[model samples]
Target: MNNNTVDKSVLNTASVKPKVLLDDAPLSKFHIKIAGLTFGAHFTDGYILGIIGFALTILTPQMGLNALWTGLIGASALIGLFIGSLVLGWISDHIGRQKIFVFSFILITVASFLQFFADSAIELVLLRILLGIGLGGDYSVGHTMLAEIAPRKQRGVLLGSFSVIWTVGYVCANIIGIYFADSTNPDIWKWLLASSTIPAIIILLLRIGTPESPRWLESKGRIEEGQAIVSKHLGENIVLDRQEIASDAGFKLLFSRKYIKRTVFNCIFWVTLVIPYFAIYTFLPLILESFGMSSNHSTDFLLNIILLVGAFLGIYFTAKFSRRGFLIWSFVVLAAMLGMLALLPSTMTLLLVAVFGVFTLIMSAVSNLVGVFPAESFPTEIRSSGVGLATSVSRFGSAAGTFLLPLSIANLGIQSSMLILVAVLLVGLVVSVLWAPETKNLTLNRASKD
Candidate 1:
């Protein structure tokens, strides 16, 4: 019962039996409900994050902002996301996921609506940072909750589907952005910024009465409560053994030899993938314009639709292939696409857009693993913290990319900037092949030990 030493026998049995029980459990309405509710938070987070790109397009001229101010404003939320994921993720490990889950939505909803009242750049930056915190919490808490509740057989599909929902929200934001982009009305940016509140409020209502994660409860030694909840969802005859209870290690466990590999893998891979993604998408309008294509709202909208389709395909493939295989292939393809873009002539405008669309498609597929791998790779006790730390660190890369992308485009030129991203993707591919674990069908407890 020592807090520092896990009962290995329990973990060994847990590695096998619970997976069988969960895999065989009949799919129920509760499973669908949990997936939907947890995914809702991700959906809202995507909207809040994606809408900013479009809002800034208009706000730049209105507020008379410069490049430094523009980058700072764009990176502000990403900075807050870093802090929020690290702090709240650690907090959730001790307090509980449900509390943080509900609180995050409330914070997001309030922060999003407050954007309507902001008249200055500073006010908008502060509010966006607050909104990012809530989104960050959702990244840690929401993904962990879904992984804990999902059937072992379906975890990849369910967790990978998180990105699909995110894509839906991102596409919706772009659609709204396209609709309002040309409005002469001064308040159009305000309306665009505030629109995220609608989804947050609705998702909050849906999640208000949701149950706590059963895996988390079991990890906390609340065996009866955990079993009861699991039985209600999976079936009443199911019985979890005592050995499956995890040792109650604090946040330091993340650095312990048992977990350090996973922690390192998640952090490195996530940063490598997210840097280019945030950099490219955040400046998509500008990137298109620089390529001599129309940077109009309609063009952005069409590209987002392509992204949505690609995301759906990614989710489907996640369910169909090994996690390691899918991810390794994704990195290779992404790197190849970027490399081609960097080397190809800029005068090939139509060819450039076509290649860009393919790049987005592969990127969407690769991104499905970001949330799933971290959530599944850690034990229930440190799942949030592990995920949080990885997310927080990766946000640093995202923030840097978002902040410097304009400068890179200006100084290095599009081709050279893209070459840099190609290098990043290649690094990710190497790390993934060297360290990433295959997590498809493993029980939560078993997957953690990998």
Candidate 2:
């Protein structure tokens, strides 16, 4: 449509609040189906990005890559992610979620498979960028679809599961990387890079039955079609939480007075969280070795497992606490951890390990809300666009950080790098305190209005 997307979904949503079937619906197989589809997509996401750190270790010497080339190769996928999530997210909002949702993995699968033939550093970077484009698009559409359809009571856990599964996939990649570390074969990196295709294929196949979000359908004023899907899939008695009459909506609507604040607010939290995360994790083995904490990869392995466990814990906290409370406190705790790490002496290895573990744990927990917050922060017409905007902004920061991290280590030392991270987290903490809205227990329509 046009830029006139003045949502009426929230108008009558406050009335008959107790009788909304979707808000009260219990967990069912249909929900599991959708959840599984997202899980596979996220798992592939983790595998693709996570394996690169290790693969690059083997590829670096063989390919004769310098710091600049290494940084460009590493940051390329995230750069592609910045472009893909921004453009495709708006497209999904206008047309539909499932088409992009299913098609994304196809790009991921093909690009991943093509990595084996890459000869030059630039060629490999191009392949990774292609994979990231698919990944970024899926990030916007996959989370949006799940958020819209999840039961209100279990929304936090269902949506937050994205973080948990992602960590699991990342951990699995680490395990495989560790196994491959023992091989003397020079070309092992190609196998590791190309291996993501298997999981990507599986995810693509399982996504065959995913239905489009009924909220998206009805939000576009396709009420009968939306209702038909609801009855055929969910129970006939399950009424949607919001009844939307389609209004004009465009990319410009996201920057309108009503939503520009939410857009900026979500982007701040997302960017600060992901910059440190992807930058640090993508080069985790190298960074840990520099700190003299993991001469044997033991420390790196420990942190990945802990990150996954912490992600699971985060899902609980998302359900257990207020959204605003969780967001503000998580930043507080994270900033402290990183700040302490910056100040602490490197000689204290055990203490460093403990502090690092705590940092990983707390960061993983808070990261869950990244998926939950954006989807809850905008109306259906602009929800994916809003989420994409945040994703694109965050990925830009992540790309820059990932690209610069090794350079920083070379010039500034690990201690100074940690301090810079402390600064970033502090920014997130301040922004969150000033702007984080309480969306807990509110319906999507109501939450977006906040």
- Which pairs of residues clash in candidate 1, taking residues 3 or more apart in a chain or in different chains? 10-243
Model 2 lDDT on a 0 to 1 scale = 0.85
Give me the displacement of residue 194 in model 1, in angstroms. 0.7
Candidate 2, residue 197: how far the Cα is off, in Å: 0.7
lDDT of 2 by residue, 1-450 (tens): 567765577666654344346656777788888888888888888887888888888899988999999998889889888988998898999899989998888899899999999999999999889888998899899888888888878888888889999888888888899899878998899999999989999889888777788888988888777777877887767777566664667668778888777888899999999989988889887777776776466666678779988999999999999988998888888888887777877798888788888989988999899888898888888888888889999999999999999999999998899889889988988888878877776676434564
The lDDT values for all models are 0.85, 0.85
Candidate 1 lDDT tens digits, 1-450 = 779999889887776633335444656788899889888887887787788887898999989999998998889889889988999988888888999989988988999899999999999989989988988888889888888777777788889988889988888888888777789998899999999999999988888977787777878888788788887766765555443666667678888988888889999999999999999998887887776777776677678877888888888888889899999998988898888778877788888788888999989877889878999898788999999999999998999999999999989898889889999989999999999988888777555465
TM-score of each predicted structure versus truth:
0.92, 0.93
**What clash count does candidate 1 reach?**
1
